[model samples]
Target: MSAPQIVSGLAEIADRYDAVLCDIWGVIHNGRESFRDACVALARFQAERGPVILISNAPRPSPAVIEQLDGLGVQREAYARVVTSGDATRALLAERAPGPAFKLGPDRDDPLYEGTGVTFAPLEEARFIACTGPFDDETEEPNDYRERFEGAVARGLEMICANPDIVVQRGDKLIYCAGALAQLYEILGGKVEMAGKPFRAVYDICLEEAASRTKTPLDRSRVLCIGDGLPTDIRGANAQELDVLFVASGIHEAETLDAGGAIRAEAVESLLRQEGLKANWAMPDLVW
Candidate 1:
C-alpha cells in the first residue's frame, strides 16, 4: 500500500534486478514503430543485468515477434530473448485434444494455428475458437464480432484467447484486442481459455525463458516487469509477485499525469488502489 516512487529513468532500479521482463508493443514500440530510448534502455539493462527478456502478449510465437521487431527497426541487442503469448498459446493448443477450430484473427495471426494439428473449420463446423483479435483492429470493434461469437456459443465452441490484452496503444489510437472479444464471449456464457499476461501460464513461460537465457534461477523478487498496460502487464506482474516499473506516458498518461505532464502521484496511487494493483516505480517513459 505504499505510493509508487516516481523516477526519471531506469537507472534508479536497474541494478536491483537480475532480469528485466519488458513488454514489447507499448514499451519498446508503438505498434507502428520502435521507441529509440526504450530500446536503448533495454540494451543497457542487458549489459548491466543478467538478461532482459522481451515479454509480450502478441498472439504469435517469439520468431514472429522478432520479425515484427526487425520490421520496426528495434535493434538486435535490445534484449537477450523474446517470449510471447503466442508461444504459450501454441503449447496450450498442442496439449489440448485435437479438434476443428475457427481462427478469429487476421492472416498475420495464422502462425498460431500452424503445425498445431488443429485443423481450421468454419464457424458451424468448428469445435473451438482461437481468437487472436479483430481481423482489422483499426476499423473494427469488439461488438463487430458479436454475431460470430454468438455462433460459436451456439455451437458450443470454447475460445482460446491468445493475447489477453484488452486494448493497446497504436500510435495515437487505442485498438481493441482479442481479450476484449474474449471477455464479451464470456459475458454471453461462453468458456474462455486465456494464454497471456495476467494469466499464470504465460508468466510461467516468460520466467522459464528468463532463467534459461540467463543460466540462473531468476529470483522473482529481483525480477522487474516493465510495461505500460495496467490490466495486462501490471496485473500479470503483480500476480507473479514481482516489482513493476509502470510507464506513465503510455496508455494511462491521461489518468496519472496533470495538464503540464507532471506526475500526479496521488492520482496514480488512487488508480492503482482502485485496480488493486501496485508498482514499485513510475517513470514518464523508459530511458537509460
Candidate 2:
C-alpha cells in the first residue's frame, strides 16, 4: 500500500477523476448540521466532474432521508443521485417478505419496510430479524440485545443488517449502528447478511446509477470516493479498486487530529497502519 497524499482540498486533485462517490453522515453532515464547505465542494465537483453520487450507509432509502437532509440544511443541488444501504437492502427484505420478521432498530427507520410487503411480529413469533440499528440508540448498546439475539440465533433466524457500519458520528459523539448488533450476533453463532458499504450490493447500485447519469463510458478507475469511516467507506472503495480520500475530521478525529482540530499527518498514517489500510489521499475535512 502507498502512503496517502495529504492534500488541502478536493480541487488539488479534482481533475484526475471523472466522477465522485461521496459518503453522507460524516463527510457532508454530522446528523446535527450540514458542513457548508463540504457541501459546496461536492456541488462544485458535480458541476465540473461527470457525476456526484451520494452513496451512504443510511438505513433508509435515499428519498426517505431527503427531508432530513433538507432539515439539516444539506442542499438538494449538491449531488445528482443518492443511493443508500436501505435502498439496496429493501430487495433483500422483499425477497423474504411476510416472513414475520422481528424488525429491530428505531421507529424512525420504519420507512425501510414500507411497500415491501414485509410483516413484523414480536421476537417470539418472528421468523427472522431485520436490524437497522439500536431501538434507542442514544441509550442502548449491543449488549442490551444479547439475551434477545441468543434466542433468535438458536432458532436459526438470520439477521439482515441494513447499515453495515458499527458506529457513526452523530454530532460530536459516536453512536452504535446496525453493524454493531450484527457483529455481536455473529459472535454468538448467528448468520448476518449485509448490503451496505464494504459489501457489493450498495456499490453495484452506485456504479449503475453513476453510469446512467454519465454521457460516456463509465471509467471505474477515474472515480474518486470521499468518506470518513475506515471500514465502510475506505475499505469499500479499496475492495472496488477505487481511489479513496479519507476525511480525518469525522469519527477518527481523536486519532487523526490534534487538540486544535488540525490534521496530524503522522497520526493519520499511524492509524491507517494499525488498521492495515491505505488511502490514495486524505484531508482533515472536505473543502474546495
Candidate 3:
C-alpha cells in the first residue's frame, strides 16, 4: 500500500489534534524574531479550546525563553507553557557544579549557567567545556572551533552541549549552533554530552511541565508535535509515540519539496517506515 499523503495546511489538521507540541526556533520564530503568523495561529488554537505546549531545544528555562520571545515580539499568551533544553541543562549543572568549565559560546548564551555555581575557566584551565556556540557568530563556522576543541581535549576538558541543533533558521539565514560545535568536538575525540531532545531528560521535563498545568494528563495519542527540524523534533516525537506535523518552511525550504509535493512527504514517510513510527500530518509551515 502507498504511504499516507502529507497535508500542507495546518488548519485542516488542527481540529483533529487536541494539543500542540511546537518547536520555538524555527516554526514560531527565527533566532532573531518570532514569526507573526505562526504566533497568531497558536493564539487561535488556544482560543479554540486546544492547548499549546511549546517545546524547544533552547538552552534556557521557560522564563528565559519568555524573555527572548518577548524581545522578538512574541506574546506570552500564544501558548499555554514552554519547555526548553536550557532548563534541563541548568538543573543538571546545579546538581553537578563547582566543576571548572570552559564556555564555548557567546555571553548571551551563558544565561544557562546563571546561578549554577559552575566555575568558568579558560580552555587551558577548565575541567569541562559548556559549548553553546561559536564565540563570534559573525565570523566563526563549526570547523573554526576545531583548534579550540583540540586545546580543550589537550587539557582533559569534557564538553557539554547546551543546544543540540546543528543549524537553525535565523531570519532567512542558517547559522551554526552549539550542537555543531559539539559534533565537531566529538569527531575530534573530545568527550561531549548533550542535554536536549532526542535525549530523554529534556522531553521528560517538557512532559512534566505540561502535566502541571492541566488536570487532565497529556495523552500521547492526542498530542501533535509540530516542528521544522527532522532529526530533533520529528524523531523526538516519534520516540514518545506522539503524532508529528513536519514544517518544511522552517528548516527545509519550499523548493526542497518536489513535484506533487511528494518528495518531502515521502522523505518523512520513509523515515517513519524505517523507524516504525508515523506522523499524523505535515504542513508547509504555520501561517495565520
lDDT for each candidate structure = 0.88, 0.92, 0.76
> Using alpha carbons, what is the TM-score of model 1?
0.96
Candidate 1 achieves a global lDDT of 0.88
Candidate 2 lDDT, tens digit per residue, 1-288? 567999999999999998899999989999999999999999888888778899989899899788888899988779888999999999999999988999998888999999999999999999889999999999999999999999999999999999999999888889999999999999999999999998988999999989898889999988999999898998899899999999999989889998987899888888888888889999999999
> Model 1, range 1-288, lDDT digits (tens) per residue?
998999999987788899998988888888898999999999888887778888899999889899989999999898888888998899778766477778889999888878888877788887888889998998999888888888778777899999998888999889999999999999988999987898888788778878887766778889999998889999999988999999887888889878888888898899899999999999877898
Question: What clash count goes with each model?
Answer: 0, 0, 2
How much is 33 displaced in model 3, in angstroms?
A: 3.9
Give the backbone clash total of model 1: 0
| Better-scoring candidate (lDDT), 1 or 2 | 2
In angstroms, give how far residue 276 of model 2 lies from its true place.
Answer: 2.4
| Candidate 3, 157-181: lDDT as tens digits | 7788888888888787888888888
On TM-score, the stronger of 1 and 3 is: 1
Model 3: lDDT equals 0.76
User: What is residue 244's positional error in candidate 1, in angstroms?
Assistant: 0.8
Candidate 1 error regions (>4 Å): none
Instruction: Choose the strongest candidate by TM-score.
Output: 2
Of candidates 3 and 2, the better by lDDT: 2
Sort order, lDDT high to low: 2, 1, 3
